[model samples]
Target: MTAPLILHYAPDNASLCVRLALEEMRLPYRAVLVDRAKGAQRLPAYLALNPNGLIPVLETPQGPLFETGAILLWLADTQGALMPAPHDPARAHALQWLIWLSNTLHPAQRMLFYPDQYTSGDTGALRATTRQRLITQFDLLENARYANWLDAVTPTAQACYLAPLLRWPALYGGPTDWFDLARWPRLSHFARRFEARPAARRAALAEGLGRTPFSAPTPCNPSEGSAI
Candidate 1:
């Protein structure tokens, strides 16, 4: 007997990537919303699944899993699709970026938007510093000459991960000029292409992110979190 798949998600959370991946793979699963605004993630039941109190805890037949990157890799490997072969060099490359995105880029985003979550003092200066760091990180990615497997006919886990994080920096009420979309033409183009995909659209709609997903390079109207 096959174990069931259940995804605990908050609308517009990093779970967006997992939802998009499932749709891309045509996998069936249930999504349970963990309302952060109402503190559902902190409840004892949810805490049993993920002590981190973060959005997006994926419950698999084996057990509950936290961390978006790990969940994505597991799905891709187990589903035998949406990622390079396990031993392929491309798979290694993909893992490298996934770690960087999850560890560095994701936290930078959290710091920029929710500095208060990390520090008690005034956060204005810290946000500015973090924004610059993010710009530098983006610069590295822009010039890395990395191949976008996501730009393929089928979207990969890496592509799914990139789409949301790229969108948030532009729309998180941070200074627009600090991280302008125009600066990273390659990434901007990548995001636009991802947004145009049917699977991406479905995920966006399912997450209540509205139709015409990623309409413009402006602040996202929906409440979103990157604590994957």
Candidate 2:
């Protein structure tokens, strides 16, 4: 069978999650670089493929799946292992957190890190305020969601989807004083595991991401965060 083609121009973190799922499952697939950093995803060909112009377009035999969460759910259902079986209570519970990461955690990062992309400059102050509101939601998610990050009983979709958020405040180059990793020890511990996985390392290298700094312990300069 021909491997499905996955066209992704994800800005490092988004690509990371899909790469993790694909590698963990050992599925044969193709990775087409949309290279959003170079404005490739914004081109007409890519826009036609995904109107939102987001990375992570997973082209399966069934059809194309856009959005990372959508693609993840498709993978889990078709392959049914990244997550537990749907009929199982743990599966439904895990599924909720997966959706939460996509809907809640992911959106917060976009607002906090790339407000300019989704909103105008005139709305900068307002966008920043809105991002704070979103951050509260993310903080709530950190506290109440992904409670099983350290359980490791059967790999219920835990922190795999949250690597981006763990790196978010740093990704945008900000004070970690307000966003505490110490508060979520389990996830902080779990995140380190896959972020250093051989497959993850290979994928990051393939995407041209800087090797030494991939798992950033330091924040970027506050003023230097740019839209990708």
Candidate whose lDDT is highest: 1
Worst 10 residues of 2 by lDDT: 218-227
RMSD (CA, Å), each prediction: 2.8, 4.4
- lDDT at residue 192 of model 1 (Cα atoms): 80
| Residue 157, model 1, lDDT | 87
User: 99-188, model 1: which lDDT tens digit per residue?
Assistant: 888899888888998898988987998898898898999888877755666346668888888788877776674576676666888777
lDDT per residue as tens, model 2, 126-184: 55575577557655755674456444633333445665557666546333455655556
lDDT of each: 0.78, 0.62
Q: Please list the residue runs of candidate 2 whose C-alpha ends up more than 4 Å from where it truly belongs after superposition.
A: 11-13, 117-124, 127-131, 153-158, 173-180, 208-227
| Cα deviation of 182, candidate 1, in Å | 1.9
* Number of backbone collisions per candidate: 0, 0
Candidate 2 residue-wise lDDT at 183: 57
